[model samples]
Target chain A: MSEALSHRDRCAIAGIGATEFSKDSGRSELTLAAQACRAALQDAGLTVADVDGVVSCDYDLVSYGAIADALGIADLTYWGQTGPGGSGPCAMVGQAVAAILSGQATTVLVYRALNGRSGRRYGLGAPDPDARVGGRGAYEEFFAPYGLVTPGQFFALLAQRHMSTYGTRYEALAEIALACREAANRNPAAQMHERALTLEQCLAARPISLPLRLFDFCLETDGACAVVVTSAERAADCAQPPVLVRAVAQSTGPRVQPGVMYPMLMRPDITVTPSQTVARTLFSRAGLGPSEVDVAQIYDCFTITVLLQLEDYGFCAKGEGGAFTESGALRPGGALPINTAGGNLSEGYVHGMNHVLEGVRQIRGTSTSQVTGAEVSLVTSAPPPGTSALLLVRG
Target chain B: MSGMFNDVAVLPLMPVEDDHDTGGFFAAARRGELALRFCSECGQLLHLPRQVCFACGGARSEWRAVPGRGRVHAWTTVTHQVHPAFPTPYTVVLVDLEEIDARLVGSLPGEAELEVGQPVRVRFDRAPDGTTVPNWEVEA
Candidate 1:
């Protein structure tokens, strides 16, 4: 779908860093951002002076100028914030690649920092007066009056439609939950690392929304993850093997059937995600298909979101996501591994920046649950709206 | 605030803001009428009220009354009170209007079930402050 972006693979992720994912950092998001940025710069064998551009997703409170000031970097040329939600990590990387290739800036650092738990939980309604009553508050005005809020409720509607149409069972969703938790148990950094989760446990978990249980929700975490994207030329001199940015594209679906929180009503079907546009363009731009992907770090804001992404991204046929994960296929020792670092379910949610880190680790072969002979890793953002994805190859 | 005949006692967790783009729609709902954004240039119906029409990019649009009837497109029941103001175990249904290619997210009485494609009709449930809010029910 994208005929341009011809400079594909011209830039690469030379460094990756993160503060530990947790429930409370006991500090400000600004401190968390600086720590991650310094570690990433160090990992790249480059000092803060080398960084000229900064990129991050919108929800992150720290501004690029604030970060640059914190890092004591004097020369600033490029900076940006990708669109809202968990869909911006890879997009930020893409922006860095574009900026570096165009010579707008070099040594671009991308990060996501938040006190998601200790400060502001995304699941809770915004307590601010402006967000609740100002012009942009139309979002709240239209839907909140009916108690139709929260990401869980929104996805629940999408999940039920997928089930009613394709006969997807609750167990299918349970398998996804179980696999992510199992992977988390093996990864020490995962918040639920020690907790054993079974199908029965998931099924018995209290329902948050009728079709979704507590386990289906992503943990509200506090932390930051950062990566440095630079030119392939500069990356060649870095300390670590660079993960090449193979291809990247972003697009949303036509508003056919607008939902409360999401404007996607006019889409041909509810089960289909806006990721379709990105997936098509991503595979086309990379000159690769789903089979070429060695492993995946699909966004898992909820268990059902993973299923929708699997089908939308062509990992499996639509409505076949349930069977796709039934065999522990998404597990470490399975056919197709997913969310190796425990994902949002087991791992802490730093918005979606951790997904990109996992992608880089898989290509680097440094993953705690590293896949065998992994080469190309696919990373996707939350879908069914303006979704985005990136392909990382071992450089 | 036209319809004062019946009032629902449940106060909404938040207030619905009706401005230049949406005051008419909300006013119609208060008067027990369902209004959609109709594009004069393309003869298309837009929703959620915007300045420019999605189709034809028409800037000239007006509110058009439509029958308060439709079918359940999809729905969800919230069992968790993510916000203390929001009551637990409530249902929200997105209705595909019979009059046009648009959808509306509204509430249904706690007792009703929401099956996809089930026929439904629009009704009003006033907030605790007696603000009339549109809702839905299964068609008889």
Candidate 2:
């Protein structure tokens, strides 16, 4: 396929906006969504009236039409919802790009809002019993009975395997958490702002699951984030400098089924993951490599996830992430400054939406803890069964 | 299988449907056995068994019996209990079956003794209903 078909002639993120990271927004999810949407439009020098398309994750209770109606945007030409939690941000951006390229709409607004901290907590356990009764409940039914109910428990198992197989240490994982905390200390909007964590502190934190301390997991927060995507041509007319969407791709691995391990074991390698497929495809399409990335906003739902993604994205050789991260490679002055906005670990988890906003800020040179001279950014999401990568460049 | 606890309220009993067929999950107890359905036309083993085959968009499907022998693909010991239904410090396992291309999840009777890739056989326990719910026992 031509560059235009593969990467060019697609949508660009014209503006990005977010609510201040908080443990609790003390407001409804709908209100949070509207605030972020309005802020994004203001940043783009556009109005809510300019957005003709909307896309979001499937789990969001708020519907596309509801957002459009609340934002007072007239007739939406395109609207879509993608699955899996953390992957939504990247997938929604891709959907918006596709919508723009296909002429379905000229301006697409993608947003995510969650009261994950104060409201219903996903980490608590399996889906509600009502959800398990129907066909949709099949996957949960298989695991819930066996007590593999929460994401933390499920990922902890993977962490144990990584530790047992590669001798990865809990202290090394704590270092990753510390780096994120130190970075967030410089970010005024980070939920854990100015709260520096020491290895001792992390070690003292209560254990949520074996091999995963409370600090190792992302924070539950009530927040919202939104981004605007429009044609590159339209972006030129906008007020702020645009962040070109150089490439965007999504992929699924051999075992697409959630909570199943057959495909994972059948694969030739346990360390190498399908997220690499997304990264490889994205780099090839964007004509960039790991060295060229000035900054990265990797999804850090869990520290192990960040480590796994580092390997899968070829930032380091497989199983080398523990050591790579331990060497301070992710620090601001380091080779690849990851999660400069503190990431899900310290920045509060908005379903990885804030990471996308941080990417836009890095290119704009407006981040609170900006990576100086940064021109290119890599944003990745490792939703179970697959990964999504997006290459964004400063315009 | 004979000594397996059938009256444990903690254990959940449900049916397994062929990925291709969704008429209803075949009734299985904690130790019961049933085959996954497949599309006769497409030969595709269905999961989350539905009324119609997702492959080839066909509707015809039939279940075939197979020995419930498998190996552990992955397992986790949950040390904390977030839900009231489950007791803390239990083990959950994903087992890859030999006769079918699918994998299933169940309690790891004794996870400390079980290793990854260890052989196991399905042992069905009688449920409140006449059907059985499938659980696993390490092969002798």
Candidate 3:
């Protein structure tokens, strides 16, 4: 193992901000990106001038230069973007940390903004078949021709394999949807806040794809979320108590990364995700174990993602994810309260950026479904086509 | 095989066109055969056929035929409509080609009840435009 001269606790998430979670924001992605960045800077007690760096998801419709131009920042010393959308939330922060630690820039703005519902729904199946740009058409031809077009369908293939291999039942999947929806009920900002979900409801919900019902899928939302990252010293002076970035790691399982989102089928075992590789590096660098994580914001792009991640992240033994979730460990005040602010399934999917904002809240003790004394917060990105994770602790 | 796909009849049968790397896979499908690319240098089978061998970095590869028999590794009955070309209620299956050590995805012609490990075989579906795609059927 390499020396643990890690950059743990060297920087912290100083502030987080977001627009109202909704189905239609009626704003351009650039506007949403700019607004969220402004709100985040204000929350950090900093201004556009204080932001020497910017980091965002490459999938974000708004570019860093566009955000910089919109925010009227005179100059930016560093700017970066990470990929494949949902897998980028934690990695975006990791990029900001790299920029900060390497003295490339300081006071970075990490943001993800999208009008997912109104502009272009990600779940809306295959793209234009005529446009072959970016090689998407080529990769998609294999699956799209078979009607395996959407992320839900792609993931369902894996979920089906997991169920067959481990005897994982649909009830476990329901438990995940229920836990996240129940958390969303307490979060007023969540799109599903006013709606409550029951086990019967989730079970009765129509199947979008077999093994994954309607409720098993995440909400198509329009919103933006941003957080300010700075060195530990600068974070202490911010408006909110610093949620130290203890560790950050991103990885792709060997040979599992192909076709970006559709490569899950290529794995030797579909049930295992890239989270297993990321978990080792994340905890080793944090100098903490999964047991020490007081709360978690596991990426909930799909209910199965959480179930598989539960096993892959070492929270429970492999093949025991179904039982672990059914044990009520993911509920508020349970062994590990997850998605306290609703997560993608309920809160809103600004991709997984909202999950990061919620992690900061859990550590700040401001979550609506707060884990009483959550000092260690775990946030993970999507599991396939590469994955990323972050370990945050109270400063 | 034209009437064989009656159960899966949709407005547009093909949602995507084949590109350079996938041209061979589609061509093989049109010829009513299952051919996959094999790396000449490293002897690796490339499914979802790539131009080069990711395993050996070998650019030399040729199309090779194998028995189009496999087991249903996973499947899903897609009810929600995402594209207008594809109507509701079609079963998509992922096949585990054990012999070739490769995997392929295709849609079952009907709402066939399926389970993991069920033996299946591939069949070719030719469109009116002479486009042929490989689909799966459960082996008796």
Candidate 4:
């Protein structure tokens, strides 16, 4: 138990890779998964055969066995899936580190593949009603039928509560969209690269749900992203300088609510996210405060999400989120540069794996929108805040 | 928004999602009363009915009638059409039920000045299929 608390920096992510960010990749998810995994392994100076362990985000439509077949990987010592979104690449890295430390596996590969735009519209609708019918909960069965279908509508409740409690303005959320779009304009890979966002355009953008406008939602992108993790010793010899995992922590609120949206009835404060609980353990394990984080790749499912995360991650005080994000602090050359790769808003939603890749890039000082002298990058995942935060340090 | 529920011309796609957990809710709505789930062993009020008590892990459950008065805990007006049954610019609300100690998600009829913590009352409205759904009522 004590060893578990002190195991930070034991494993390092040696490589990161992703397919082109796009609205339509015109390829099966299996193909995208194989391509990304191959790219990551090659980047790490390791072959598929060297990988004895595999992990996947729960949201990934492709299964581990299918990906292994596509990668031509023969044997596996450790294999598992962390989340459909409850835990993402960061948590997967945590699992990989645990396996390596226990001698259950040496090299572990974590990947997330989704054809969100072409195959399944992530922003459009509810889960399969058949699944809901066979079995579902309040949000699905009771709440969903009342027109609470899409994630935007679900998160709208959070955004509304946040605004009411803190007197937050729409302009606060607009700052995030503007900052991310500006960063995306600098990066050629961003899906919304040329499409810069202005505060006027953002405010005037058609409302999807009140308190959440069109600019609030993330792009419906098609792609896959992957990362390679190995022993810290092994990563020291890899082609790219190792990005050590200083700390990786995944946590849920007091209630063990499963699925995309946990019933918020159990929680006292409607404005708080899982990131609040997650950030404490993450910073504790890393022995570093939020102020030490040079760059951040916070999950930007919605602009309001960025505001909530900034507060939950302790960048500001509770209810000070609206004021905290008003400055250009999240942009390039700002106080705490965030989402340098444009994030899910302007970049692509590789289901938070892209955020992890950006975190690794920031640590390595190779990001196109690089923050100068970034030694540590804090990356966070999406909500119920089925959130995980990882601190990556330059090796 | 006020009472679009009064629009006899509109037909709802699926008024309620019927499952083991929420079958009682629709049944209660049919009888013109708001009912909620409670774990007797745990003495806890539960929403989105669970087969087992999540807190105490006890399977025994029962339903109790609630007064159906609540405050708008959080709400949003969805301008986008998610389902044809629910038209554009509809307001969806999560209500914190008053003495009952539970929360319910319901819709307000038409565009109205709504805010969090505003007092509201629940009223039974007919889904096109005639299944009763609890809708929120407020003086716009």
| TM-scores of the candidates in the order shown | 0.94, 0.87, 0.95, 0.93
- Model 1 TM-score, all chains together: 0.94
User: Cα lDDT of all candidates, in order?
Assistant: 0.81, 0.75, 0.86, 0.81
Q: What TM-score did chain B of candidate 1 earn?
A: 0.82
Error of 4 at A233 (Å): 0.8
Best-performing candidate as measured by DockQ: 1
Rank all candidate structures by their TM-score, best first, as comma-separated numbers: 3, 1, 4, 2
User: Candidate 4 at A295: error in angstroms?
Assistant: 0.8
Candidate 3 chain A TM-score vs. reference chain A: 0.97
- Model 4 chain A scores worst on lDDT over the 10 consecutive residues at A129-138
Task: Looking at model 3, give its docking quality level.
Answer: medium
TM-score of 3: 0.95
Q: What DockQ does each listed candidate score? A: 0.53, 0.35, 0.49, 0.46
Give one digit per residue, the lDDT tens place, for model 3 in A1-395.
Answer: 55846789999999898988888998898988888889898988999889889998878888888999999988999999987789999999999999999999988999999989998888986466443322443366667777777899988887888888889999999999999999999999999999988999988998898879999999999889999999999999989999999999998978864577885676778888999999999998988999999999999889999999999999999999999999999997788889988989999988899999999998998999989888899999998688999999989
A1-395: candidate 1 lDDT, tens digit per residue? 44474867898899988998788899999999999999898888999889999998887899988899999988889998887759788788888888888889988999999999999888986544223331342445566666766788888888878888888889988888887887788889888899899888888999887688999989899999999999988998999998899998887766633332455544447788878778998998898999888899989999999998888888889889888878667877676799988898889888789999899999999888899899889999877447789999977
Candidate 2: regions farther than 4 A off: A1-4, A129-134, A258-273, B1-5, B10-31, B34-71, B97-102, B109-114, B118-121, B137-140
Residue A253 displacement in candidate 1 (angstroms): 2.3
